[model samples]
Target: MNQVIRNTALSAAISLSLLGTARADDAKDIDTVVVTANRSAVPADEVLASVTVIERSDIEASQAPDLLSLLARQAGMDLVRTGGPGQTNTLFLRGGIASHTLVLIDGIRVNSANQGNFDFAHLPLSQIERIEIVRGPRAALWGSDAIGGVIHIFTRDPSAGYIEARAGSYGLGGLNAGFGTAHVAIGAGFETQRGFSATNPAAGPGSYDPDNDGYTNRNLSLRVHGDVGTQHVALTGLITDADVEFDIGETAAINRELGIVLWGEINDRWSHSITLGHNSEDLNTPDFDSHFGSERSTLDWVNTFTLNADNTLNLGANWAHETGFSESSTEVSFDEGRRNLAVFASWRGHFGTQTFELSARRDDNSQFDGATTGNAAWGLDVNDSLRVRASWGQGFRAPNFNELYYPGFFGFFAGNPDLRPERSISQEIGVDWLATLSQRVSVSLYRTRVRDLIAFTSPTFGAENVNRAAIDGAELDYHFEHGAFRLDGNATWQDARNALTDLPLLRRPDRKLSLSGSYRFSNDAALGLDASAYSSRPDIGGDLPGYARFDLRGSLPLTAGWTLEARIENVFDREYQLLEGYNTPGRSGVVNLRWNGK
Candidate 1:
């Protein structure tokens, strides 16, 4: 813990020193537009919720290896990886459980119905254009599984063509290429690595493994959009397949998504959109002879009416069908299906400097009772430089197939036929200050109470609704850009505990801090530093230790359209563990060469 604190302080000092020596330049004003904060496009600065927008430029500049690595820098997020690449990745948002957050790709839900969580390990950075993270409860507009918040990933769009190849430590190598015309684009990527042992030998005799674990992935995506008369239409498809080797078993997974969207203006005051989508996953464990498959098909139609310059009305209806299936060599099996129909509405009113938003949703499920959620928020812009916002919302997470229908094996493990969804109510207040054109700051405070949490307990060792949680949290985010240097940082403090036991939630650190800074050179080259620290937290195995890590990145332009990028991760050779029994990556470097068609 002392070492962790020292490292964090050193990182802060480095960032501050860089800022002091940075060249003075006029920072450009970028007005980020986002849709996840609301169902419609809105300026990020005007949104009432805590939101983070990560663009393609930022993604490339950071040189992060995967989606999980990039998301770990954000506030209010706790990431736990069981091992190296291709391992089990779990994210707890706003101190909520791993399954409480909703994940979407192009507005289509992708979480598995069996486990109720989406794996971020296989989502490559090469195919993603941007990511929008909204913190706090969003179920009022998005429905179940949004008790924590929402992460919406937008795939790459048609733009300049590019191709790249990379090689890193631990026998890591990959290729990524993309090409696009005015209305169509395609992207493909392949990655393979001989990773270190996933489980540490010190954990236990049963978990000891000296051999290396290997991983391989192949992914492809296609996107097309065009204007047909007065309406715009888009079609998107993505597929990914991955194979992973563990100590005693091997697993393979295939994931797919398809979407068709159409939208257009009906008049000066009204516009509408229709989206049809499908997401599915098929996973197999060869050594265990186990298989799990899940799929979700959805339809959504939304209409927006501009009542006036200061007011708007949004109405939408959604329908979805989900199914899950699983089988194991132990003669255990699970098969279940469910359907949901939902209707939602929201009203936004801007009165002078104060803005008001109210949204509600009702989800009627085939297997359980209906769930209704709502959100009310108000924001006030004070003299154009300061803003204050407050909001209250209700959210829920439905029971997954494994918790409700899994068949007992060897008279040991069982499932409860009767289970209720977990529910939560949350409230938050925030303040944003644009101290200057080159500096901005945001602070937020929140509290949440959750009830009817599912847990496996004594008696039958089956799932039951017997737990509750109380979470209180705070966040501070800062951004500064002066001339050729830029800095961004955030700090999070959360107390997430079980109400009955007063125990800390698993793998949720009580404190987290991150800092990222970059300096641009006169020759068009750039150097960046990324550092983070996390406090110790309890895991299933035991109390994991606190740690800190740093990464160095740089890029240089070469001939014509070619460029070279490189990153040295774990610059200090800091040893850390996100999970109690899993080993983490050590000092490693990756070099990438790319040719752009711009």
Candidate 2:
């Protein structure tokens, strides 16, 4: 282990040095990035923190259905999507828990206050303009769940008009049509996907068919933008619903979800956004002869102000209410509410030959009885290509409603109302290098000490909820691009140990690596390949071996407005389990025909 750590550190240092020289040669003049990071538009390359961007072109080339699959393909990211379409999804970064990652749409938080996570499967990819990912603790800037990092999604604006329709395997069909002309624009999209169950037939009652489950989903969105004198105005609304049949062993469970979001923005330097949404998850288990349902509603508001060219500030507040019910007629129903308020500030200035940035934020959570948390980060550009950054932040997560009110089977289970919010103090230091005009590299070492880490203890009649543990890790990423060919990869090594028992954290792997490359065959055609490998993880009761998988993508421009795209996933058909009892799909191919109406 020591040798591995040493090797990683040395490699990181060398990569950073090479990247520095490369960035100087590849530097280009670009516009400022308008993001929720600081609630304003700022020069992308000027930001003092580590941020990764995925443009629309990257998404089209990847040919993934949802954000989870696309993000999973990125470096230093771990994603779990249960079964197929319409299932729940979660992401883990830099050894942080799944719930520690915060997700934002336009500038509003999409994470469920009650469930403590976002359902990535429900987010449509067709409407996204771009995705920006910031790694490491960002609680000081975003607050609360930003212990791991932040993922902000920007939807396409109505600057141009477009319409497209596509159909594929497994009852899959889609239609996306929208129009926009500078001041006025509107559009809508719909999609339907079929699901399948995968269970071994030889396993008797515990076994089921892997190709019988099905799912259907639909979505509608409208957006408008206009300029009013010196101020800009924007409005967006979305509604989505899904019905799915998920197979569990010999039984089939039906699930449905409905969600809505409305957001507005005004002016370039000042804006406010709000979101009101609801979701319900219903499940049926034939073996237990029981039916379960959980429902939740959320309201969020965020405001931003650019104090000046060197200063920016942001304020956010949100409230949520949730309830659960069971068909067994037990008093398992409860009403829960959560409120959060936060303030943050960031500044950039130059000191001699070096550019510097300072940022800080404070957050208060009502669920924890007004507990206050804060974080701060600073960065220094040693030169045009050499930059160093350090950050320290505190993050917290309130116990879920199920952990506090759910009753166990046979009336033997009970909820814990005395549980405290899990908290963590994280610190990281990293360097960035622009190795060449078409190459970049970065490395970071981080440590997070968490207190009251929430986890389920002994599960005899019911599981016991408790807090305990710490996680530390390092990450490295490198990218090289030259005209029609590009090479990129990232590796992450981590150690998560239980503070109390001195045992390794369950389900957390020690090593993860991913690499991808793409080549353009002609002005109208391109081919891409991706590969990922994960080390074995110790299971408390099961044996899970290491696994690796590969994927291939190809695209050909057929006409001025139409294109042909194909993707082959699970190229090697390596069967692996990211989570117990959940198996991923095998080799599959998808061909899509896309048209962009100018």
Clashes of each: 1, 13
Candidate 1 TM-score versus the reference: 0.94
RMSD of each: 8.5, 8.6
Per-residue alpha-carbon lDDT of model 1 for 261-291, expressed as tens digits? 7766677777777888999999999787899
lDDT of 1: 0.84
lDDT of the candidates, in the order given:
0.84, 0.62
Candidate 2 lDDT at 197 equals 60
Best by TM-score: 1
TM-score versus the correct structure, for each prediction: 0.94, 0.82
Specify the highest-lDDT model's number.
1
- Residue 362 shift from truth in candidate 2, angstroms: 4.2
Tally clashing residue pairs in candidate 2.
13
Q: What lDDT score goes with residue 577 in model 2?
A: 73
